[model samples]
Target: MFKVCGYTCNRNDFLKKHMRLHSGERHYKCEVCGYACNQKCDFKRHMRTHSGERRYMCKICGKEFTGSDQLMKHLRIHTEERPYTCKVCGKSFYQSAHLKQHIKMHSGERPYMCEVCGKAFKRSGILKTHMRIHTGERPYECDVCGKAFKRSGILKTHMRIHTGERQYKCDVCGKTFISSCYLKTHMRIHTGDIPYKCDVCGKAFISSGDLKAHIRIHTGERPYKCDVCGKAFTQNSTLKAHTRIHTRESPFTCEVCGCACKQRGTLKKLMRLHTRERLYKCEVCGYALNQSGDLIDDMKTHSEEGLFMCGVYGKTFKQSGNLKKHMRTHTRERPYMCGVCGKAFPKSCNLKTHMRIHTGERPYKCEVCGFACNQSGSLKKHMVLHKGERPFKCEVCGYACYQSDELTDHMRSHAKEKLCEVCGKEFKLKGNLKTHMRIHTGEKPYKCDVCGYKCNQNGTMKIHMRLHTGERPYKCEVCGEAFKQSGNLTEHTKTHTEERPYMCEVCGHAFRQSCNLKTHMRIHTGERPYNCEVCSKAFAESQTLKAHMRIHTGDGPNKSEVRGYACKQSSDIQGRNRTNVTFAMKHSNMIPGSNT
Candidate 1:
């Protein structure tokens, strides 16, 4: 029952000296190695190299260590005991340090900071790697590839190529990889498992990398920047390819096609197209694809039915890309801007077609309908409507579709074998299951064709592609309001209808969708997921988070209310409506009376 102050005052100040040991404030130095350490134990460990001391030994493995902590970590291999446990998920770790790192998974605490880039990391090891940017120190080099890395571990892994070492082998497929982590990821293909999932969208991924990319959809963290255009990327590979544009370095030269690609993977895929090699074939549908990604996109035609619906006509699409394009008819997210007329569009393909108006290029022509289009795909879809030919039919359900891709998508709803092991979510197609598994594992496969924009879904990539090509197809029927897609038209129609379906339970406020409602609910609930790294201030949304971050940079408050208050004059009438005298009087009287 002794007070902390009473006990601290009575102590002989030994604790202060002990704290200096933990802080690593050097009072001692080794003349031989020029190593200075604060603690006696650290000095003792450093002296081991000079003395050649092998006092701490393991009887089982005959391994020697200079420190007690190293010996304790090594003993875990023999005992196989994981004492440290995470409170959030009940995950166990062999080391206390590992357990502490695992705790950050719940708390999201990033303690380590890099002075060069001002990037924060949860682990000190990551921060050390980040410091290399400022120092320009790449210690690890691959002898085979002549590639350099900042870390020694990465160099060791790269050396595996020269050694032809396949140290890690998949137990299920017998596939070999240089690293255990890669093998662990490959194992998920056989198991059909995805452990990681997005809490916002319910999308699953097979790996943490995929999850990180998906999180960018919510946070919009484009870390990798391009020197040429000041454009940013989420992945390193994307940034590498983008740098090639400035350098004009196309290392990947095709032997057959003679086409040069910045990325080796893209070149490899292009080589397959030249060879006419349909390596990946669907077992259920007998559909063949040259690339695995194309096969995945093809499979989505079947599995993603009733999920991605058109906001315009309540029609569901198998692919989110189609649905997103369809949403342009409603939201009027005409991001693609033309340099000519200052007009914008939603889809790049549509923008390309629009460009034809200026250029007078009609590439696609209909034989029966006598309508010509800039794109063949549009003409094909248009021809189906004219001919009434529903050739593509589902074998299981006998549902006929005009397009073969649409039929393939419909057939997936009938399939029952594919299932994600992590979330237990069922999918009709294996490719969809693979993509869905990415939601759990957090693997992002789709990349932007223009800007190397990597995303979990092709829809996001398509939206990103619009930044390069200006395309707006959907035009308002009443006011000649041009839009990018049909969905924008529908959403624009809502402006006329004034129909708000989404309503907040707490405040009874109506909104267009559940997302808007949820965002509004945060106002009352005071729940903010987005936070500023500089000041550690929480924000309800990413926009708010960005505005809050600006404050740390000596920027003014970005909130509309705060800006309005700052701009307001003392004599000006302030209320809901300035013109409505009675309404202004009512609101003005209530403002001082209410706590808000």
Candidate 2:
């Protein structure tokens, strides 16, 4: 007898053939497939796959295989026999190869390791599948969609999507699934068996994948990152959903309103808006919500226990995420930033809400009035008008309001005033009085570093900085025109409609803007706020004051010709004025048909 590399052989020639496994020698090669093997018998089996030859057949299921051992394994399904059983877990399998793989899992022995990523696997076949991630080799292609996959088993499962073949059925719910593993996970809903649990958070999950994703919260590990925004997420699916913000891809569509969403879960929630089906319910308060996350948030209101505490202000929140957001308020951390507008926000939802102004997406709508709005909070406020519900009221004056914040603001009228010493201006809040003082002191602290533009308010500085950056984030949906400020977008939207709310009482003239009406009123009052410093001449408009100053500087119209300069040909001035007009029309949408 002869032995080589743990394989015993009866002859020396057989032992020499077995030695080729470790020696990295492949003598037998198939001409058609280029499949090389150490043994001639294994090489012959590889040829049978391309030849479409099945020599052995199973009588019970009418299935065929190229080898007798494969036929024998198929027969075990009809016999309902699992001869190979694991001693550790009592798990059984039909084939000895499967049992060997299962045993290695119990021993935590992963001998097969990928050379590229260093990922260990219990079986060599699994390691080969993992190698495709680095190699970019996808051999299995779908016939219908042409979508490629790395493994044959995954391709087989994907074929079920086209065929609609769901063989695995749950006995309890009668729900069907594509695979037995999915069915097993579904059965846990009925069994209430959450076997997988996070050791760090003590949160239980139905599957190991859910537990693995939950563990990332404690580890602060975000393996998946966005290529465009550099935003990291714990799950790959979450990163995929986030990438839609840059891509603007809305694959999932609603049937009723033709509304589109980037994710299927978002489409499902949008469908609930039309259906009005409250699927998630609170056990304590009997409050129902269409979204499960909203239900989870509502459930927190029922309990005061396990509240997260803020270190700075000592404020308590029901969720750790809310507590983390509260800490950012104290730290003045604005992590979520808009790539388009170059604006930073403390919360991601604030950034998302800000993005809708640029996107012109009015996702929320009033079902009663057919009115649509961008923000969900705006929709909720609009719904209050239709519902006519004044739940919040002042206790002292009986001043009722739709929102609690409005009632709180009304309560300030009853409180003592915060007086400004310089101007004798009485404000309801101390912060308002502080802002009022800046006007009297001529103090403009918020300044743009780019243009040295000064403003008393930080928000005005942010808007002014956009002028230097040439960023017009707000966009009109109808004309596809962009604007630097949201107030400019609001004024531009009025051009799309003939709804002029501002009117002159003296002249009976209507205007779309209150600022225009206020300027028109100055003509009737003969009030000239803009006064020329050179001649003490007054004008109703600031542009008139600027034109009057040009006369004193000898730069007025026809003044250069009077000074014997021949007006300087002014092609450069005309070109610069044209360029300025073009830029202003592009960013501020001053011209109506410029976008078209």
Instruction: TM-score for candidate 2, please give it.
Output: 0.57
**Tens digits of lDDT, candidate 2, 263-369:** 98889889989999886667778887887558656766777755677887777887788898888878999999999979999999999899988898898988899
Report the number of the highest-TM-score candidate. 2
In Å, residue 581's CA in model 1 sits off its true spot by 85
At residue 422, candidate 2 shows an lDDT of: 79
CA lDDT scores, all candidates in order: 0.76, 0.84
Candidate 2 residues lying further than 4 Å off, grouped into runs, are 1-28, 36-46, 53-64, 67-69, 85-92, 102-121, 166-176, 186-206, 210-234, 276-306, 309-316, 327-344, 352-596
Write the residue-wise lDDT of candidate 1 on 434-504 in tens digits. Answer: 77877777788897656676878777666666667776667777788876666668778777788898888
For model 2, give the RMSD to the true fold: 11.9
TM-score of each: 0.41, 0.57
Question: Ten residues in a row with the worst lDDT in model 2?
Answer: 559-568
Where does candidate 1 stray beyond 4 Å?
Answer: 1-33, 36-150, 161-166, 169-176, 274-292, 295-307, 311-316, 326-337, 340-346, 349-596
